[model samples]
Target: MAVNKLVYYIIPLIVLGLIAWWQFGFGGLFENLKGGVKGVIEMAPNVSIGAEEELATEPTIPREHEEAINNLVETIEKMVTSPKKNCFLNYKLLGKNYGTNSGMPSLGEGGTTISFQLKGDKTEMLIAGGAGGKQEVTRLRKEIAGFKPCVIAGSNEITKNFFNRYLGQGQILGDNYKPVSIINIFYDTDGDNGNAIRVPEFGNEPVNDEGDNFEDEGWLFKAEDGSICFFPTNKVMSADDDGLVYGNINQINTKVGVVGSGLDYCYTWTE
Candidate 1:
């Protein structure tokens, strides 16, 4: 009888011990395991830390304008640098035009016209006029021929070759070379009494015979109609030959109004 009683007592104690282990001891073990897993996660790569910073403010231009500008820049870059497309040329106009009654001067008040006299590896007469008089228009057409299509390439080798031929060698019409003319126009839209823009200086002195002048400087063209334009004077050669012109367009700041409306923009090219 005593033996039976002792066995019963020992079995109950063992059961109690197992239950305690399953409840408290096992729970503690699982918690330790979970903590170890969390530590591993903390030690893992901080992928988010290497991400680029987000912009503090979003872009102001409409998506369409942004896209159009981007396309224009890309096209210009390809024309400048593409070995195949080296024969092509590009131009751009900046600023906006508001109605006369809107308190903004007409396009005539601005030098909104551009002309070119190109002669080189390829011969062609080409002309593009701004919003002003037919004199600028007619003269521009008489001076140049129709534009030729050039191949567009993305490789640096192709771009280098195009730059060498078009810009470096001046081969647009064989050997005879002429100066490239760039015209800019600016307009004041707000009618702010003292709002006037000074032409930025540009030139290549003692370097090339092209009679480099203020127009040669990379400038932002703002039309009296409030159109903002940018010409890649500094990077024109490279931009035309390379396929990466869009990158430069993104660098422009359009907040500086010419007249007022920022929606006015235009561009063209000659070669």
Candidate 2:
């Protein structure tokens, strides 16, 4: 009875969300979600989060587990922000060596995968490829949607490989290798979840690359647009031509579970 009622309620909402996306826009879906509703756009009808995204005023993670989550977030932040600066300059940007740091969950694969379990005394540490030995590979990417964990990644060749190889595996790429163009963000379950967006804006470059500038633009930070909005997690129906992504998945975090009954939104670029 409860299951039937649940299904009866969710189906129309999903359809309505899609129709809304088609008619109104991405903003419309969010508006609906904020209005105490949940829905998916035309891409997939598998999403079902409650007031989690909007009303998750407190951290759903157990108080004891808070430390582990903090450690994981801090590590991720370090990797995303400073992983490249320490590497040799030549290979930083072009090399597939600089990207997300340790403590990433294995999406699914042989060596690089981690079993989802309680983060006990281990403190949720994911070593970089070189430091961790083997780069954890995100195999079975097709299983992302079916699996509840929203820890997935997408990008171009160089960006993808670096994120997996170095950050996930701790292995640095060859010399002069380009670092990753990163846009990773974790929605804060505690408070101010709204401000937790990773790459805010992606747009055209106003200034052209001249010889005088010591800081040249590399693929790591370069993009077709100024901001990367609701990424792979964002609904396909709402994504504009520049916001679609279809890269192979890169897994992060071993503590697998839904992001607190909230949609783990991501954007993938498409040709």
Candidate 3:
């Protein structure tokens, strides 16, 4: 009877212990314990710990050279965003001294070059040049080709096309269309000829010498050779505010391709 009573008490205690463990065990308890230990350790400071300490040095601020470079960068950025006339004026000033025709033979011919000695890093100098003329522009473009900048080059026509066609726009357009119109159409297309022809709605036909029916419902047609041909449109063509006209050709049942006809081809109508 004594042993039975003892076992009864022991069993109840063990059951209670198991219940407590199940209710308040594992992650919560471990986290609490870890936090408490960390708190205590943090409170107990000045404990000798062996660690490699970097030799203390005075905090270095931007040197005059770096400041000058930064200022130049800012100026270039602002000039790029400014009005075309203002940009041209500034470009002229830069071009005058460093320009291709500038009397300085060291600066090369046809392009404007600007050279400044870095203020802090006195050993090195920074030279930047831009060419607006056709030959110089070509040379500059060739030099920068395949070069990637730490700071992304701001959007231009080429960059915009890359994003809209090469990157995310491909996925978006693919999802929306069954036979997705390839943005590659902007470039070359098989059976389209040399390139897509662009004819102005108000101006003369693109190919003046080649005699064709100009009055007929002319189309800015993409030839099978991947060439674009511009023809006159006899009928009234309507365009949206965005300047995109959506339409279909008789041969192709589905709508495909687009036409830009406004000033500088500003209007783009996609079908």
- Which parts of model 1 have CA positions greater than 4 angstroms off? 1-56, 84-86, 90-199, 202-271
**Predicted candidate 1 versus true structure: per-residue lDDT over 1-271, tens digit per residue:** 9999999999998997787678769878578666776565456523122221121111132233233234434444443333331122223223433322211133333323222222442223232223332223232233222222122222345434433442344333221111222322232333222112222222321111111111211223322222222332122434432221422333233321234423222333332
TM-score, prediction 1: 0.20
Tens digit of per-residue lDDT, candidate 2, span 245-267: 22211122221123442212121
Pick by lDDT: which candidate is best?
1
Estimate TM-scores for all models. 0.20, 0.19, 0.15
lDDT order of candidates, best first? 1, 2, 3
- Model 2 C-alpha RMSD to native: 22.6
* Candidate 1 weakest ten by summed lDDT: 205-214
Give the Cα-based TM-score of candidate 2 against the true structure: 0.19
Task: Give Cα distance to truth, residue 11, candidate 3, Å.
Answer: 39
Per-candidate Cα lDDT values, in order, are 0.31, 0.27, 0.25
RMSD of each: 21.2, 22.6, 25.3
Counted clashes in each candidate structure: 46, 45, 26
